[model samples]
Target chain A: MATRQYSFYPGCSSQKGASSSNYLTSVQAMCEELDIQLNDIPDWNCCAASIGYAGGGELPRLTLSARNIALSEEHNPGQEIVATCAACWLSTREAAERLHEDQSLLAEANQALAEAGLKLKNETPIKHMVEALIEDIGYDALGAKVKKPLEGIKIAGYVGCQTNRPFGIDGESYENPRYLDKLVETMGADSVPDYEKKVQCCGGALAFSEPEKSQEMVKGIIEAAYDHGADMIVTPCPVCQMNVEVYQDQINQTYGTKFKMPVVYYSTLMAVAYGRSAKDAALNGQVIPAKKLEAIAAK
Target chain B: MGDLNQAMIEKYRTNFLKEVEANVEEGEWVKMCMQCGVCSGSCPLGKFWDHPPQELFMMIRAGKRDEVLSSDSMWMCTSCYNCVVRCPRELPITHIMHGLAHYAKRLGLVPESQPTAAFAQMFWDNLMQKGRVNELKLGLKLYFMNGFGDGIKVALKHQKIGMGMLKTGRMSPMEAFGGHAVKDLKGFQSMIKKAQELEDQRIAEHGA
Candidate 1:
């Protein structure tokens, strides 16, 4: 297979020693197996994240992402910019879309960018890494590369919000996105295709600000996964992975329920299925360890 | 802040909806809502909210300016985009929610003790410092946001997780000194400053 290259934008969460640093690790491992080269956009800044609108307003928020897009255009020209973080992808893509649609906003954004020795061309295609995986590398090819099929494992594909709604993966329904399920099935796992809360919200950044409300939402997601008789849960978004995995202890205490389900990323699952070691798959990063997946990696 | 708030009230008079449409991002779409309750129903945190998205839009049209801006309902939005995709009228409900929240903050009407609003400010300050967020400082700041006593309790509660992350190299204590920064820090800060000035100017011109 020929090598595919993309300018990678690992957002704040995926930065070294940040919340989703493990995600970056597993993603790097997965890309190595898939023969994809991710060139880092030199000295990239935050995409203003989802909660940024409250402080950044519209134009500044747009400019923050526009700066990154401008830097990518200048440095990694002609390559599609891909983000591993869902919020990063959403904010950047939304900025590009809004800038393209509104020429006046584009001009204002460029005025800000000009101060930073940058310009908002709004020319590059912004994509989530999962979109690149599904569209660029089809399911058949992905499945063909699986060295060790994940047989006998019942996995529930949790297609949480951000990745599913607004601009979802190509040809996917907002409510019932089956791409995650298909990815699970391709890895030879028993996918719970009808996981009820697949598109449910894990409360995103509110997990820090309003723990009670966000935890309630997280409880629903994990409870639904357990109800489906699945051994583990998988998601593409960093916030989903962190919220669901790290909050189990608190949820168990708050709800008086014994919930210890391992919320792994789809990349982690793919890395393990592709015969990568547990370390390579970043299994140790899980707050609630996926013992079953770790055992699979050991095998 | 109070002067600007009062001026806006006097300008818009009894038309809160028009005020929002003129100033808020994607606020123009609020009129197309058609009173559909799908957005309210689709919200994961709808039950916890004092007024859901539908009710908020209704209140806006009713010209209940003080109640709408100080309600604290918009801050509850998680930006899940559930309401956006599910809205029958295709209202960009999520953006409107954030827009309302941002407008409220700008007018100095954010409800007292609003944690999300506080955290957003902290996150923004942290980001603008180095053009990137220092996770360690942000986490520490969040823990201590309420008070020293509350900060201690919350820090103690999450100590295990923090230690685990540190051990696994997912977080660094050294970041407290000075975390990663964009190479062109001068240019970045200047750009952000210029954008803020432009935005303020635009809002002032619109009000005038």
Candidate 2:
């Protein structure tokens, strides 16, 4: 598609030194190899994530995201707003959908925007970066860009909650979405398709609030990957990566299970598949040492 | 405990479903819920709730206003949309959960002891301050919110992950101390102020 360009919404997670900084850095490196250009939207605000839903009113949630949308529209014009974070994708997309569906809500959001001299026409479609690769660049084309396919590594694709339910990738099943599995296959890696916790909730940021239950859920997810003999669990969301990897020690201490499963961004795998350096893929950002991927990349 | 039971059986209490549908954002969808256990079954923290999601919806319907609002079920939803996707009725069960949470929170029904609710409020406060969230500040604030002694214990507990984050360059003290997350802080705050103004007016109009 002549080097497709997208308006990038890094959200808060991708900010410098945040949890998903490596995820963003690696995604960008992968995009470069795949001939995709990500244009950063100027002064984009937060995606108003679960906070908007969990604490604030509906209009406030819509308004908060609408400001970002209005800015994206002004900065990038009519280009699609592609969010790297799954929470950003869901909430921003939800705001866009809400604004589009209700005229009164649209008017109200616009009113909120009018004060800041920004208004959303509600035209741009919000997409997750994974969807863009599968839909815009196709798996065949994506594989064609791969200079070094992950041949022997067994990757269990964990779609988590955001990327699958509500607004899933095109042609992906809700019960057993294989887009991540398919992406892994396209990169010439062995995908653990039978991995049971592919769509299980990673408990989101509940790990911070209700750590015990969330850690158990994380245990189920990581252990399922191990059960299927996956070398690493690859996910699209940074929050999932943070919860999956960061909470492992806590889970181990509480549950008395010794787990050393490595959770990595799909972009890290994608970047490596495209022959980007392991360093460029930010493999060091993971809480667990990515020894398997490091060994794979060395060979 | 006796007073709580008395409040639950009181007929003069608020019509919970009516309040939800009238005021809560996505609460109108609660009526479409078929009492199917899909939402409750799909919830990862299903057993943790005083009343599981399906039963809570029924509670809301039966005008168990005090009981439904006071339950931890709303606060327990992690914003994972498992039930929303699996719902045969296509009801947005996740948003409904959020709506109920917001409704309960707005009315001060949620207990002061709820950590999840406290974290969520801190999340909102963080975002409102900077139009962004800072993990370092957030973690510290969350800890201190629980009292200093407990916060220290929690910090000590998480030191391993904290060290991992530091070594991996995911958490930087420089960014924590000096970074400005919102590029145009003044402009962003003005934008938020306007949004809140509209929201305040909207709620006042509804007398909610």
Candidate 3:
């Protein structure tokens, strides 16, 4: 098979935190096995997240997103821009759609980019790395690479709000959604029943904007997962992982509850299926201990 | 003055909850509150409120309109929706808080205990005017409007963060008057007009 290449944009959380670090290595190894070259974009900037630039006009936000896309279009040919972070996935995907839908805004944003010695034509398509692996590469192919099947493990999949809500590609829903869960099942694990808050926000920046209020939102999601008896949470978004993990202590203290649900990146979980070391996936750095997971792997 | 049936009010409770969800994310979960004490017990702020989760729901269920409207607990809810998360039935207690808060404000109840409401108004104002929120200006306005000098002190402590935003061309307070965000100023004006009209109607219908 010809080696397919992709330009991956690891958003801020991936750079600043350990979750993405663990995920990227495992994803890279999987890409290698699948004959895909997952390369990072040079000098990439933050996606400003989906909500961060809500105060700025569309142009500034669009311009910021387009600048990153422009680099991918200019430097790489044919490959889509693969965003590992949900915020980046949504922002970059919106950049492509919005640039086409609102021409006048696109013109203004391009002019701003021009001053910075860059141009954006929205030539490259923005795709989530998961989309590439599952949709483009095919799950059967991914399944073939799994050396150690995740049998008897029940996994709950969380697709943060941005990837599937407010605005996203068609055929996505909060009710009985099974794409990520199927991916988990394909790796030989049982996908747990869907819970109410699976697609909810992990409080994201709102947690910082209103700390006390944000803690409630976080606690609420954790409580829902607890209700479902989920052993771990597998998500593709780093901000969700960051928010859900960082606030575990606060949520535990406030709710008088003991929720030890581990949050694993989908890529990290897939890496485990690939028979790669948990350490290679940086599993130990998780806020919710995956000791059971580690023990299972040990056997 | 006529007596409203309890079932009739409960039937429309879903609609009221939906309205709160529209302003929030994961709003559907609000209607699922099972009256489980998990939310009350789990709530960090429950002990402080006179009308805790159970009481608030009971009042709503019984159509104890006067009691729910009169209480200060409604305004104190931070819209955290923690109750919804832990509620065995998933009642959107957070949305309830927001709806009741709005209703209280509309009824001319505790008109001053509405910092978050003012924050919402200012948020929409900025959005209507500039097509975005300018946190620097909004923060200052919110601080003064809330009459909390301590918030100003806290904000000032984060001056370096604000300066970095300015340096990055992200914190242009001057844009509040005229900038890319307010390019089509007319659209913003119309939005503000619509908001004011809505507020006026609310006050007329629900104001004391």
Candidate 4:
């Protein structure tokens, strides 16, 4: 068994019964089954999500994320920091890059860290769990682990904003990211090639604040998935899943349509394909339950 | 246009571009925008903004302080960074919009009844208080902060989502009633306090 180990940063969303708990649970199960050792960083704080960007100046937001980077450095020096939540991945990666680029900001952030007796080197590689899976564990090795190869289940690969914007996965087009599609295909599922809203924003943190606008964005994404004959939409971000899934009923009421599309994590599919049971994958926690996926896993 | 209004425009001293660049970290990068319409065009919500990104930058440069700050344009920015990646000048357009929103909030210029601005403030408050946000608390605070009637109306509308959250184990009963907070509250508070102090010191240097 090949062992891949790294510092795991589970953001606030990973707390018990939070929006991203299932994503965290499913990803953790998938990682364990795949032989990746994730050492959880002790006492990790919130990533300051979009609200940090919304209400505060740059230094405080950078400082908040820098503290996490500093902790990973202390606990698991030189090891890559892996995050399942897209917001956390974006926050940590963006902070490190900004600090690295601006010496003054780096000094300021470090000074704030000095108060906590921590100083960030900003050297640890921060990545989304998807990037680690694609780069570190190639799909062929992952493909070999599929005990129940997904068959006849058409999945729309929704790569939301953070994974590929500003800093994208290796060889990914910022405008049209295909890494998710390829992963779906490698898992023995049909990838919707012409999914237009694949790289579109699912209205991030604004889903709570501006419901009307966010619902429209979610409609565009989900409607496209349904229009393309997809049984389910698989994503890498927990926020996307929540925003996309939670808004469907309201969206349906508003638009006079019947769209109950299941928004699930890519790890959910990977776990099922890798021979993990549906319950272990946390599939039951899915908001709009995916009957097709569950039946395939059962087969 | 320059000949007719030069005196009138210059006399008002409405030019806020310099102040924004000096004071706001994200706003500093907006000075590089070359009036390329790419940002406006790339935005999903661009059509909704009264002043699209290109126009907003132009107005900012032209010293339209009241018009720029009071406009709903910044409030509507979803921070998708579509413009950030496509910008020829490498300007962080999304961040600039967000910075402008923060500036408006600081000045009490955000239009009343703007939920996004309200939600942003609530979100920050929760994070600052508990060191991390509890979803239920954040949700309740957001809907109810305005008034009881408004809260119930919004709650009734979103009840399905709430029930679904409970059903799926995504939100536990305890979490729904009372949400989770950071374990090491002291450490979290201190880090936030230190960051706030450093940020305040920097902002003060900008001469308010």
DockQ (CA atoms), all models: 0.79, 0.63, 0.04, 0.57
Q: A1-299 in candidate 1: lDDT tens per residue? A: 43999998988878878888999999999999999999999989988888887788899999999999999999999999999989999999999999999898899999999999998778999999999999999999999899889888899999889987799999999989999999999999999989998998898999999998899989999999899899999999999988888888888999998998988999999999999999999998887788888888999
In terms of lDDT, the poorest run of 10 residues in model 2 chain B is B3-12
> lDDT by residue for model 2 over B1-208, one digit each (tens)?
2443343334334666766776677788888888879888888888898888788888889988878877787888888888888889988878877887876777668866887888888888778778887877888898787789988998898888889998998987876675547677777777667776777666545542
lDDT winner, 1 or 3: 1
lDDT of each: 0.91, 0.82, 0.60, 0.82
- Candidate 4 wrong stretches, greater than 4 Å: B1-15, B176-178
The full ranking of all candidates by TM-score, starting with the best, is: 1, 2, 4, 3
Chain A accuracy as TM-score for every candidate: 0.98, 0.97, 0.91, 0.97
B1-208 per-residue lDDT for model 1 (tens digits) = 7877888988899789999999999999989988879988889989888999999999999998989999888998898998998898899989999999999999899989999999988888899999998889999999999899999999999898797678767888888988888999999999999888889888887676
RMSD after Cα superposition, model 4? 4.1
Question: How well does each candidate superpose onto the true structure, as a TM-score?
Answer: 0.98, 0.95, 0.60, 0.94
DockQ of 2: 0.63
lDDT (10s digit) by residue, model 4, range A18-87:
8778887788778888889898887677777866655666787888788888888999887899998888
Clashing pairs in 1: none
Identify the CAPRI category of the predicted complex in candidate 4.
medium
Top candidate when judged by lDDT against the true structure: 1
Please state the error at residue B206 of candidate 1 in Å. Answer: 1.9
Positional deviation of A282 in candidate 1, in angstroms? 1.0
Kindly report which residue stretches of model 3 are placed more than 4 angstroms away from their true locations once superposed.
A16-19, A166-170, A296-299, B1-208
Better of 2 and 3 by lDDT: 2
Cα distance off (Å), candidate 4, residue A271: 0.4
